[model samples]
Target: MGIEIEVVYALPDEQVVIPVNVEPAATIQDAIRLSGILERFPEIVLEDRMVGIFGRCMALDHPVQAHDRVEIYRPLHASPADARRMRAEARRRRRAGK
Candidate 1:
């Protein structure tokens, strides 16, 4: 049987609640599409993009359970590993009084 679930979108200034009729085995991406988020936020490009569910990184096609919170992640401009390396280098220099 189809189920009704609440899909929430955390926008810049507001929250959008969409009640969706979904099969119990739908992925988070499917839920977002059903929620019309891609239609609402045209800037969200999903190809090769990372996604998270309930604050944990997950595969794009990861299955979403009922009441699951899905969050689409935008690509970072810089690599986090590189940023950390830079910070560590700066700290080393400061310690050496250079």
Candidate 2:
């Protein structure tokens, strides 16, 4: 028998959820490939994007358990440093009555 798992991906306005059954020994990547999420989300690149389970980043080869929810992460539009800098600038402007 195979284990059932959910694969999820999200966009700014949409979410893609896929349910699949794979061997208990299957890796997270295996379930992802079997779920066909790549076909559904052309923008998703396994090589560049991150994958996780239950909100924790994980390796693609990580083993999957029954009912595990795998997630595909999109690349960040802005780096953390850049975001912090931008926010600081905005705060300064607001304080200065700009």
Candidate 3:
């Protein structure tokens, strides 16, 4: 069988996953370009973003395997530390019945 892969991109309220079929040993970049994700989302800049396969960081040159899931990550609006602190504070307030 031929190689089957998925390219996924998400926003705060929506997500798109595209299934793509290719010849044996397609690279991640090839899959992303073929998926038409960039055309759909004009805001995505390939040079400004990071992409991964199954949540693991991958290079554009990396060869894809069968059933590989490619993910395009959006830039975070807030820092992880700040987000965690906010969540913790909210939890504390809830526990105090605020």
Candidate 4:
């Protein structure tokens, strides 16, 4: 018997939930590869994207526990600093227009 867990993928506008059964101590990447999501989304093939278990960011080789919620994260559109700067710029523009 294998350990069964829930895997959730948060797409652009929707969420895909899947049940996965893997051996204990399986890595996040291992689970993702086994779940067949890789074939569906080739964009996630990059290593820069992060993977997590149960909402906590984890390493690709992190061991999975039974009933864990494995999540494959998408790459950020922009860095945090950049995003904040953009937001501030937008606010400045709004204030200037006001």
Number of clashing pairs per prediction, in order:
0, 0, 0, 0
Summarize candidate 4's per-residue lDDT along 1-98 as a digit string, tens digits: 78998777798899988898998878888888888887777777638787898779998888888988999888789999999999999999999999
Number of the top TM-score candidate: 3
TM-score computed on alpha carbons, candidate 3: 0.88
Instruction: Write model 1 residue lDDT over 30-60, tens digit each, in one string.
Output: 8778878788878877666567777788876
The order of the candidates by lDDT, greatest first, is: 2, 3, 4, 1
Model 2 scores worst on lDDT over the 10 consecutive residues at: 40-49
Best by lDDT: 2
lDDT of 3 by residue, 67-97 (tens): 9999999998879999999999999999999
- Sort every candidate by TM-score, greatest first: 3, 2, 4, 1
Model 3 residue 2 CA deviation in Å: 3.7
The candidate 1 region of ten consecutive residues with least summed lDDT is 3-12
**What overall lDDT, based on C-alpha atoms, would model 3 receive against the true structure?**
0.90
Q: Between candidates 1 and 3, which one is better according to TM-score?
A: 3
Alpha-carbon TM-score of each model against the true structure: 0.62, 0.84, 0.88, 0.79
lDDT of candidate 2 over 1-98, digit per residue (tens) = 99999999988999888999999899989989999998977777897889999999999999999999999998888999999999999999999995
Report the C-alpha displacement of residue 18, candidate 2, in angstroms: 1.1
> In model 3, what is the error at residue 96, expressed in angstroms?
3.8
